[model samples]
Target: MCAYQEAGGTDMKTKNQSPRPALPRTPMTVERGVALIEALVALLIMAFGMVALAGIQSTMRRGSDQALQRGEALRLAQGEMETLRDYSVLSAEAAASGPAGTRAYAGVVSAAASSAGGNTDFSVTRSVADWADPVVGQEQQQAGLREVRVRVQWQDRAGNEQFVMLDSFIARADPALGASLGLPASTSATRRPAERSVSIPVAAKDLGNGTSVFVPSPTATVAWVFNNMTGVITGRCTVAMGTLNSSLTAADVAGCSNNTVGYLLSGVVKFSSAARPDPAQPGGTAWPLDVGIVNSTLNGAISAPVHQCFDDAPTSAANTMAFVSFNCFVEPNNGTPRIWSGRLELSGLNLGGGADAKKVCRYSADYDGNGSVSNSEHPENYNAVSGSLSRQNFLVINATASCPAGAAINPENGVFVNNSTVQQQPR
Candidate 1:
């Protein structure tokens, strides 16, 4: 009281009389640290993305490897095909006549071989076994022809097996090759007709008929060059099919400038892989002959006019070369006519001729109750008959059912092909 009286402080403190109430206390702010959780979530998503990317990368790598392997296999197959084309000889004459390095066409299918292709160990194989599958490859097969396939096989890193194949054909008639190889110009005596700008041949018009018939002709086949290309790379020349001689003649659409003739008669026969012969059937009976040697010359000397027909067929039932219906026209050169007196023998292909050379088709024919085939018909048999009297099937003539006086063949005429078309390559 004394101090207030001395300074009159009461007047100076006149504001809100009571001491100013303390402002209400604000509660302390708090935060729930969510950044860490968000960061964790982002990391998890990133991890998943990384895993997916890793999977994609692995898949791409494997695919690349597979592509490379496939290409390599294809290349290997192509190389093998080229090698075969360069080294193979169609006949024994060609083999012997080849300049130096030539080998038999049969040798091309020797065996499967191993080679290195990139990082893979590849197996390479050549075969005409496709003929056993019937029409699967009939376009490239014929009496004087063989279809060769070059296959390459390898294993991938994923433990999967992979393969690629290249298909081609080899014909006994490659004039260009024959000429280049310097092979002799010999013709098979078997009679046939050729046509078009190119002409093939038939041995001889029978000099006589029936038992007195003699085979073969000379200068009938004109020089032709087989392209030696695959059906894939090239196509075949063909004439619309019809009756053998009556309606269709080689000269109708195509004919040899020379006496040349070519006849290709075909029909499908069921077959399997180059399979084994059936044990159920008697030996040699399980399959048809691998190579059939028919001497069109009956009375004439077995010379250049000899017919060398090499073939493979689909004989699934027999588990060997397939049985294809075969019919060709041949008669006495004298125009006489023949009967059943010429039921010839034939041979077989199996165990012996498959594993390697000398085994491709060891034959077995037992005609005349001989019980066995003479052995002299082996290697030496190609050029000429090494053994004259073996039990193999020979010319089975078509009988004289009806005789039109002035028929195309008159009494007995042969059937033949007229034209051929090619694909992928030029004539």
Candidate 2:
């Protein structure tokens, strides 16, 4: 009985500890299926990550492109501002409204804008008062600075407005010339007395080869005297249709053209013909003049070291040289030439230049003996003239001179003249 009971107990214990039938032998198929599910989930996660990365890259690219565009536009505006700093003055003819409505200086700016794909907007206004005036920050003096503003704007990819502004200030009359509009009397006293007298006889024989007088040689000890007349340099100019039907003879020129009146004489030019004293009328009257062309008249008169002529005909044929020249108040324009009319927007000045002027005139001054050419060639030409007075291109005196003793001649000293042909038309 005892043995039977022990055997039974042992059999029961063995049956219970049968190793659980090796856990029913796991199915390889199920394991593989599970592995696939895990792999798919991982793949899905990776795909989501890739999609997010692509979106980010696309956004970044668009932003970058917009930024690039803005940068280019800003650069355009800044470049325009920088480019105009040296050319603020315009000739009277260039300042005049021709059959075409554009002024010489404005035409130049427009041409530049067109060539640049019209990426910017330009406008010019003149002022004879304080530019930064009303004494916003400082004392209100004559403050004759021509303010030029170039505003640039564009849309970003996000449809946001982007803009950049460039500002330029130019002096209509350079203080150095002693002809500044609001110059104090004390300052004028410090300057050397002007000696250019209108009575000085200009020898016609002295024409050509860098000479001003047209008087025949040996006009003998000609004496030039100043009228000693002084008048306010008013910006007001009167325009009239004097005698259009009159003959084109030099005699009728006086009645047909606009006259500039100023008594405070900085310099005097002597010419023979009272009716048509100069053939290069604009070249003589408008050369180097800083009649205000600015954004705000309050910014003051546009002044720069410029040449002014009181006559219609050139004193001498050689006097065709101009540091700055504007053909007409307006020229044939808008992709074609017709009687268009518009006001002038003086923006910059033609800094001193003879070398560049000489080079350009060589190509553009074709009608050298006939009349004047536009001063829109290049400011570098002005710089060339300013580089040295001895370059023999064009000479503008800063102060008046007395006859003989006070006389100042262009191409002074080291200047040499050449009989080279001028080029005006484009190739």
Candidate 3:
């Protein structure tokens, strides 16, 4: 080994040793970018989480805002309803506060911004209507009621419109509401149900027998006449021989006083013509009017039914809208004994829908206590608590003070036809 070392080769194994046989070439430890891949994946997952969190946050914010807005709208509606509750006074159509102040019975109003600045955000409106509800309260009472509707509207953050409403009924606040009647709703006693109009046709001035409007059976303490003549076939309930017939009489309309006046003569009136106004005649003896009666009944008992036509017609005759109808009922009907007629109970519908609905003196059936049909509805049965209306002026009879001869006002059954040879018909 020493001699070889002196040679030119110089022991390649000891000198170079081929770099220790190249260490088998470690294979260069190639990397497939796994760390970078892991980093990218982690970044993507983090981005997804951030996006989810952001969405959740936005949804929560919107939900919270919506809840808040709804609460505010509810509060506004409640406040308005409470204000109406405190009105106390009832029947605002007549005497709500004695003066011109319209607090409770301010009538219905259009949607007006509650905020004086006209902030389109919130608006408030009220609807006041006259109603006679018998079963509204506990048990039964003749309550002059008014329905009040309060509405509050708003827009949510999402630009969606939202609203709230409050509806309820209130009674009359007349100083003598509970005082005058004594027995609650017993003051204006009426028959269980109104008699439907008869189909028979009676002559214009025929005669029949009856007592008071209520006591038409069993002959009571009063005497009245009727128009149930022989030629007038449909007895019981009667209709006119022709449409627009003046001094018309049908079967035993309620009863009649003497040979002229009749009461409770309601039946289906098959109009000869469609009962339209005759513009050629301003105010004739019997002007035709498109009148219809809607007496809503449930289980054979008469409850107050609001007529659509009456509600839609103008309260004032001067309105240019063309139609006019008013609900009419007699106050103090059973007591006080109105010799002619007393104050009337009235309601309003469609009072102001475009035209200025006004109450004019020139009416078709309205009477002003002069036994004349001017301000009152004669032969009208709008009062669910009273008998069919008595005619005025042309056959307008008296409500109290003994029917001509001498008779006490009886609410029970009776046919007050004494022996009158002039207009006596088979008692």
Q: Best-fitting candidate, measured by TM-score?
A: 1
lDDT of 3 by residue, 23-82 (tens): 466554566587899999999999999999999999998788777766777787777776
Q: Rank the candidates by TM-score, best first.
A: 1, 3, 2
In order, what lDDT does every prediction score? Answer: 0.38, 0.31, 0.36
Candidate number achieving the greatest lDDT relative to the actual structure:
1
At residue 334, what lDDT does model 1 achieve? 18
Q: Number of clashing pairs, model 1?
A: 52
Would you estimate the TM-scores of all the predictions?
0.39, 0.31, 0.35
Clashes of each: 52, 71, 33
RMSD of each: 21.6, 22.7, 21.0
Model 2: per-residue lDDT, tens digit, 237-305?
222323221212333232322232221112222212122222122133223332221121223322222
TM-score of 3: 0.35
